[model samples]
Structure formats: C-alpha cells, structure tokens
Target: MKQATAKVSHRLRGAQGGMEGRFRLVLVVVMAGVTLFVLGRGLFEAPDAPDTFVNGTSTSPGGHRALLHLLDEEGFTVTSSVDRLDVLNENDFQDPEAALALLEPSPQFLDKYESEVRGLFSRSWRPPLILVLPKRHYHALQSDEDGTLVLQEGIYSIDDSERVLQLAGLGSELGVRRVTGGDVIEPDSPYATRIHDESDEAQVLEFTSAASPWRKLITDSRNRTLAAVNPLTRVVVLAEPDLISNRFLDQGDSAALARHVFEASQCRHLVVDEALHGMATRASLEYLAVRPPALWALLSVLLLLALFAWREATVLRTQPAEVDARRSREFVIEGVARLMLRAKDFRMAAQHLQQRAPLALLPSRAHVHAAGVAGSTSASLPGEVAERLHQLPENDGSEEHLIRVARRVAEIRREVSLSHHVPSARKPG
Candidate 1:
C-alpha cells in the first residue's frame, strides 16, 4: 500500500512539472509575438506628426480642415492642398472657365511650380491663376503682359485685358475699411463688389498685426488684422500666411474670414497652399529627365580593356627560351673563372674542378714532381704547361683520351718541379 502511494505521488509530481514547462513555453511564445508586433508597427507606420511636412513650414492641420469646411459651406468641392499641381494635372484641369487656382507665396511657389506656371499661361484652355507676393518685396513681382510693376507704398490697381484681374495691396487697409469699419462696399473693384456684405457674417472677419512684411497686408492702421480678400483671377491673395496656420485657425475670427473668401470665389477654385507642394518630387523628376551617359561610359571602359589585351598580345612574346638557358650557363662559367683568377690559387681551383668532375683522376701531393707541376715557385712555368692544365678534360668515363691527358698533366708537374729545383710536397698539404 505504501509503494502504491509513493508511485501515485511521483506521477502527480511529474504531471505538475510537465504542466509548468508547458506554461513557460507558452509565455515565451507570447512575449516573442508581442516583440515582433511592436517592431513591425514601428517600421511600417507613418512617421510622427513633426516629420509630416517640411521644416520651417506649418502643417496647419486645423487650418486645412477649416478651409475645407469653408469651401463646402460655399457649395465648392474641397480637396487636400497637398501636392496640388499633381492633383490638378492628373485631373486635366485645363478648363479656364471651369476652375481657378489660388496660390500662397512659399518655397514651393517660388521654385518647383515655375514650369507649371508657364504651362498654365501658355495653354489656351488654362485655368485662371492667383499668386501672393510679399508686400515689402512687392516690387519683385513681374507681369508677363506688361513687363514688371513696382509698388512703393499704398494701394495700387492693375488693369489687365484678360478675364482675370490681378490685385496686390495691403490686406490691413482692405480689412479695416471693409470688415471692421463697416465700409463693406468697394463698388469700383470688379469682383469685390459681388462679394461684399454688411451682415453679421461679414462682421465675423478678424484681423492681427503684420508678423512679417508679408503680415503687413493683414493688419489695420495699428498693423494688426486678418488677411484682405483682394481678387487676382476670381482668385484671392491673402498677405499674412499665419491666418491659415494650424495654430490660428481656431483663434478669433480667422476661420470666418477663410470661409468668406471661399464662398466669394468660384466653386472649382484650386486652393494651393504652397507649404504642402512637394519640391523634392519635382526636383527628383527633373533630375531623372537629365539622364547620365551610361552607354558612352561603358563603351569607353570596354575599348580600354580591348586595347590593353591587344597591347599585351602584340608587344610581348614568349620565345623558345634558348637565350635564357645559354645566359645561365655563361654566367656560371664566368663566375667560377673570376673567383679562381681573383684568388690566384691553383689548388683551390683543382679542388673545385674535382668536385665538379667526379670521374677525374685526382693526383696526390706526392705525384707533384712526377706530374711535372711547379709548387709555390718564384720561377715561371712554361705557357704550354699552363695551357695543358687548362685543356685537361672534364672527366666522363667514355673518353680514354682524357684519361691519358690526366697522366700527362702529372708528368708535366714533375718536370716543372725538378727544373725549378723546388722541393714539392707529396700531396696538397
């Protein structure tokens, strides 16, 4: 009974351990899944709000929404101000009577849209256009019809024969006279007369001091006010950009002024907030238009390689190498001869010759007298004996004549030693 109880306890413990291991595995899997999910969200999600627009430009999320609301209220279809040109071109907005484009002065306005501007003017079916120029540098604004117009101060009127009338002036004076001072009538102005009203809706317009030279247009005499609605081509140019900034859309009566402008304009007006136009995309396209000389570059590299191969094949050759082998043998013989001549030692030369010619019969010192060879004598040996010594054959066993010549060399040494009367050692000692 005790053994049965013990067996049951062991089984229970094993089961418990198995359950705990399974739970840990599940926990690990859940944690891994959570980590991967977080990483994927970070990688694939849109960047934070700050990175949504270019630096130094306002994203104006509220202002953009407010503008859309104003447009809708005025019975006009509203679209995002982002990449306005692409939207216009994609929709084939070349019907002049159908729509007008409202543009603000920003980096995008000054740079990327230059070609689009030219195209718009040149096209017979182009839409009416409006551009906001800074009041301080208003002199820089040029009219394609009449060259350039320079404005120093105060309000100036332009009379272009085209259907669109372009107006550039201080927004503050326009706002003060029209909205705040209850002078809602500009009867002489072509389009302003159509939109003016003395109702509470018209009084809802706000104003602020000019924050910049561009802002001076949005101020009263105190240099503070909302932007003025001066028409360009059924299009209106507002001097101060901050009225449309994300921060100020909800402040004071700015939203009302924005609404009034949209209601007054044509239903299909192309509202181009220059801040949202993508200069990077236009610049990238321009860069792609100018192609690199890749084909020419590749041809040049291939030609260089071919020339290199041709030069190596033609200018260099591998001969039979007889010259190298002959050179090697001559070098060895001359080197050995030089060493023997420099040392002036016949014994050392004989030893070297013996090592080179293994089959040669080498004479012992005792054979010096019998070989008729002089030994360390001041007396000169005959030139014939010296010549005979040099002529001694390099011993190969096939030549009997060489063996006889070796015996003759020994006799010559002996005769020279006797004639010189020099005692010679029996061996080279």
Candidate 2:
C-alpha cells in the first residue's frame, strides 16, 4: 500500500511537469511553423511600386489594362515585361507575330532609353511597336481617412507627349483638338475600316500633325491625326491615350476601337512594356531580401526573433529537476532521520531501535557459535546481546547518540548475516 501511494504521488508530479514541457514544445513548434510560412511568402511577394502607373498590369484610371483584358476576352493572349527593350530577345519579347505595346510611357523613359530603343527597332526581326503617348500622370498621397495612399491626377504637359512622338521619328506636335461641328471624324485614308466609334460627337482626342511617310490611319474631325503608322519601321503611334485608358475604355465603342486597333496589327499576341513605368521583376533571393516587400519580411523575422528571445528568458527556462523515483537505502535513512529531527521526538526513534535491538539481532559471539550448536538453541544468546546493548551509553536521541546507535546496529546486522550463511555442526553424535 505504501509503495502504491508513492507511485501515485510520483505520477501526479510527473503529469504536471509533462504538461508544462509539452505546452512549451507545442508553442515553439507552432511559432516556428508560422514564422517559416510568413518568411517563405514575403520572400517572394514583392509588390509593384507606384500603384497608379500606366501599365497593363495596373487597374488604375490612367492604366490601359482594361484594353488588354478586352483583348483577352476576344481570344488574344497578353503578356507584359519590365525588361529593357534593347536586351529583349524572342524569349523575353517574342516573335514577329507578337506586338510590343508601349501604353502611356513616360517621356523621360523614352529620352533616356532613346539609343537603346532605336537600336531595338532597327532589328529586321523586331516585333511591331505600338507607342501610345502619355495623357495624364498621378501623384500618390496619404489620405485623411487612413494612412493608405490615394492617387490624384495631375496636368500632363503636352511637350512630354511631343517629345516621345518625335523620338518615334514622327516629326509632329501632339495637342488636344475637338471637332468644330460634330464628333464624327472622317477617315480619309486606307485601313479606315478599323474605326469603331459609336459617338456622334467626337470627344476631343490628342492629335498629331502627322504627314507624308506617316500615314494617318485614324483621325478626329477636321482631319486631325489621332493615329498613324510608319510603314517602313512597322511602328504605330496613337496620340490619344484616353481612348484606351481604364477610365474611358468602357465608353461607347471604345472597347471595339481598342480591339480593332490590336486585331488590325496582324500580331498574334500583345506584350505591354512595363519597364517604362518602373515595375522590374527580379525573383533572386538577394533581390527578394531587399526589394519592395523586404521591409515587411524583415519586420516579421524580427518579431519572430523577439518571441524566441522572450521564450528563452521566461517560458522556456529550465525548472528544478524532480528527485529520482527509486529511493536509495542511504537516502531513506537520512530522510527518516530528518523527519525525526523535525518532529522534535528523537526519543521516538531511539526507543524503536532499543526494542528491536536484542529481539531482532543475533549475539555477536553466537553468530558462528550457533553453527557449532546444530540442533541446540542458545539459551545465553539473548542475555549476551541485551547486556551488550544495555552497557552502551544511553541514547539521548541527539545526533551523536544516533551515530553510535547506527554503528551498533551495523555490527548486529553483520553477525546475523554470518549466522545465516555458516554451516551447522553435526549433532554430538
């Protein structure tokens, strides 16, 4: 019964300690899993910069992404690239069947990349280029409602538009002009069937004073050029970007006009130039660790580290180890002695040993002598043991007294062990 009780008590203590250990282990595992998952995602989740850029990947007002999606709806494949035009090959750009569309590109990009772009276009195997002049730019500012950004449209200079068109080798001045009487623009040149305008009154579009060698394909009222093409270079220029931008592409016949413009190019696929608007995509580990989303990734890693540090200092600290389950003989003796001291009844322990001493132990001399007296009992054995024990200085239950008592007990145990192991002598035959 005592052994069962000891086991139960040990088990209860073990259960409590196990629970705490398990909780810490599970917490560490879960936190590690979450940290790994967050790092993996943020490592590659680099978001594009300037949310309102005029690229096919954007959905903002100034972007012409709606036209690209419409082209998809009409069974045309669309892709985009942030790679510079000069370094592009068939792998990055595509074949002659693919058309490269530069929608509302920044004039600064054109001026800076003029030499490289001209070199690209000079390639005989180059894809048809569609250069759309910039219409409006935007400014991103923090809003009053939230810390999030809101894009505000700003006036776009016409000089920037004219600069890009001139770089395209079309010596023209780009400016906005409206029809004097009606919105009906008369198409006077070949390939005029591409016009899909449903508006009776021409909403004004930016036009270019394009002439000879630059065939005006589409025009606003008064025969002002809205779109034209250089036959030799296979480059098409659209002066009016609002006709295809996300904000106005849904207006009457605008979607149809966009489709016709792309379909007439005889290109199988469309590739929008995203490099001009600064959305370069690099998936290298170095780039991912230091790009747009790098801040968020760094913050997450720091938070995880902080949590780990806190756990080490507090929750994960080592607890004082529990005592060994199996008690040693020396340990049991010292433990009982300690209890006796605490109870202030050292006499109780002394009395216990005094009773058991003579009664339980064999006399020291009789230990081997019992073997000699085979069938006979030792009538003087008890008397001898009792005399010996009684002659010792009386135990006062003090620590020193207990020490002497322990030595006597040890001598008694040794004699009893010898008495049991010795061979008995034959009866006095």
Candidate 3:
C-alpha cells in the first residue's frame, strides 16, 4: 500500500513539471512573434518625404506662412500666384493694393509671360510689386545695354554675373574657388544674410544671372543697389530669396530685415518672378533632406541584438566552492599570527589571545611573570603560552610562541602599573 501511494505522488509531480515547461514555451513563442512583426513593419514601410514647407503649406520659404499669418492677424486677405495678368485683373489695375509675386526658373514662364508682366505696369493705377529672383534662374530674363534690366524708369538693375544674376551685388562671385570646394558667398555680406553652409556658400537671392538681360540699378561694396523706386509704384528688388525662406526666417535678423523692407516699400502688390521658384524649391528641399543609414550599420546592430538574446537563453550555472577541512584551522591560526607580527602591537595581541582561547588561563601567567619569581616558570604563565615559547608543540609551536609573547607583554604592563616611582629594571645581561 505504501509503495502504491509513493508512485502516485511521483506521477503527479511529473505532470506539474510538464505543464510549467509548456507555459514557458508559449511565452517565448509570443515574444518572438512580436519582435518579427515590428522588424517587418520597419523594413517594409516607405520613407517620409522631405519637409520642404513649414507647417505643411506655403510653396516657397521666407516665412510665407508666418507672413500670411501676420496678414491674417492684421485683417488683410493674402493671395498668391505666378500670373501677372491675374494679379492686374484682380486689383482691376485701379485700386492700389500690395502683392508679392514668386518666380520659378522655367523658360516657358519667362518667355511667354513677358507681355502680361509688362502690362502690370502699363496703367497709372497699380499696386506695389516685390520681385524675388534666385541666382539659378536670374539669367533667363531679358536685359538692355549697361547691364541693367529696368522694369520702369525709376526701377533698374545694378550688378550682373555669369553664374548667378547679380541683384545689387548680394551674393558671392560666381565660379569663385573655395579651399574646401565650391564658391561660397560670405554670410556677413550686407546683401547676403543667413548663409546655410559655410563650406559652400551658395547664395540664395532674388537676382538673376548674366545670361539673362536683367539690368542693375544700384551698386555698393556691401549690397548691389538695384532698381530705384518709381516714387509712384514703390517697387523694391531684393537680391537673396533666403531673406524670406522658412529656414532663414529666424536667422541673422532676417525676419526683422524683411519686415523693414516690406513696411518701408508700402507696396500693396508683390510680383514674384516665377522663374526663380524651382531653384528656391530645390535649394530648400536640399537643405531639409537627410541621407539614409548604411546597410552595414543596420546589419551590425541586428547582429549584436541576436547575440545578446542567444546568450540570455543559453546561460550556464556557476559551480559552488568546495570545502577543505584539513587546511581550515591552519589557515585561521596563520592569518592571526601574520596580523600580530605585522602590527607589532603586543597589547592588542594579548587581547586577541584572551578572546580566541577562553579555556587558557593567561592572566595567572602574566601575574607570575610580573612578580619576578625565578623557578616559578611552571606557574609563570598559562601552559599554552609556555609551550609556545619553548617550541614544544611540534606543528603547533608557532601559535604557542605568539601567545607567549602576548602574555609577556601583559606582565610588563602590570609591572609598570604596580610601581609608580621605581624605574623598571632591564632584562638580565
């Protein structure tokens, strides 16, 4: 009956162990599935497009959104486009309103839209026009002799370059060699503000290149003064497009500087040369774009993660230390004796002896030694202390001698305490 009951208990224990093993297996499988799903999603998902526009709107930079927000805040309706005729028809060429025109570098926009652009200034009733010309498309516009592209009699161009259209000398010289490579415009130049890369100073401005016939109206060391204001139209020409781009909106006092130009001109209409839009978009997109990570770097990270998981699953148990009975007592006695010798403090040694060997009477031996009674050596100290001094205990002699030294030190202390005035006699010669 007892054997049958024991067998039943063993069977129950086996069943419980099997259930625990299956539970652990299920947990591991679930974790593995989750990891695979996450990794697969990261690998399959498409990359995000570059953030060219701020707040996800406004085609060109120059705080276009902020500018629109500002206008809306001030109760003004803001409109945008590349067509000059639409601008004129909206305002009926009669009401004086402010308009800003953004231009691209397209040949069709420059060649076909010339007549419409001219008609904007034909009527006496016109709005103020703000022109944005980037270096890439500056050469597409037609200009007259003296290197000046005059929009009206009062408004004209001042500077021109082969690489980028110079608008009032706002950018670095085209084809100028840099130590690191590429022509870099100086960021500190009055005409050029908010330089993007110091290594390659590609100036983003509203001016055209020399290939185009845009004329120059102003020239100075700091900035090329272009197009004198028509006193009536209040037209203003800016050299760098970055003056209004989102990236430069907060750079180098650009926001305040642009605001000053706008408020100072008092023009209701802004004419953007659509030819410069492509260049500006390309530049802005390039600034915001980031390079993808290398494949080797990704693989290395995955490999390290796999190695850690494998180590966790296959960890080994460390063995416990073995006990040695024979060496244990010898180790303790040797350790104590070495400490006493190193310290050279006999009083501390005596205290240690009393604590370790309570069965040995060391106090009686110390009293006999202090009395200076000859032939009373048998009772001069404890048997343990005497056996140690004479080295009579064979393998245990070292421990005995250590105890004897401690007893003698205690006796010397007693003698010094007992005699207050008498100088202690020296050991016999």
What lDDT does each candidate get?
0.42, 0.66, 0.43
The CA lDDT at 131 in model 2 is: 79
Name the runs in model 3 displaced over 4 angstroms.
1-63, 70-76, 81-87, 90-94, 100-108, 121-125, 136-193, 196-233, 268-429
Number of backbone collisions per candidate: 28, 2, 57
* Model 1 Cα lDDT, one tens digit per residue, 1-429: 856866676677678767865775666556556545544554455432322221224233312445555556766654433444434544534433344534333332434455554455445544544333221112223445767443322221111101011222233323322232232222223211112224511212233343432221233322333344434424344433334444455555555555544444454645444432343233332233222454355446456655654664467444333333545878889988898567665544454443443223333445566756756343233445555656665544333544455466667757654664534446665
Write one digit per residue (lDDT tens) for candidate 3, span 37-110: 65565566443323223211343342256654544454454554433453434643344555554422233333
The TM-score, computed over Cα atoms with residue i paired to residue i, of candidate 1 is 0.30
Weakest lDDT window of 10 consecutive positions for candidate 2: 188-197
lDDT of 2 by residue, 308-389 (tens): 7576547654554334434667788899878867897656676677667766775445656766644433667567666766
Estimate the TM-score of every prediction: 0.30, 0.49, 0.31
lDDT of 1 at 314: 64
Give the candidates in order of TM-score, highest first.
Answer: 2, 3, 1
Better of 1 and 3 by TM-score: 3
Which runs in model 1 stand beyond 4 Å of their true positions? 1-65, 81-105, 118-125, 130-232, 268-276, 279-429
Candidate maximizing TM-score: 2
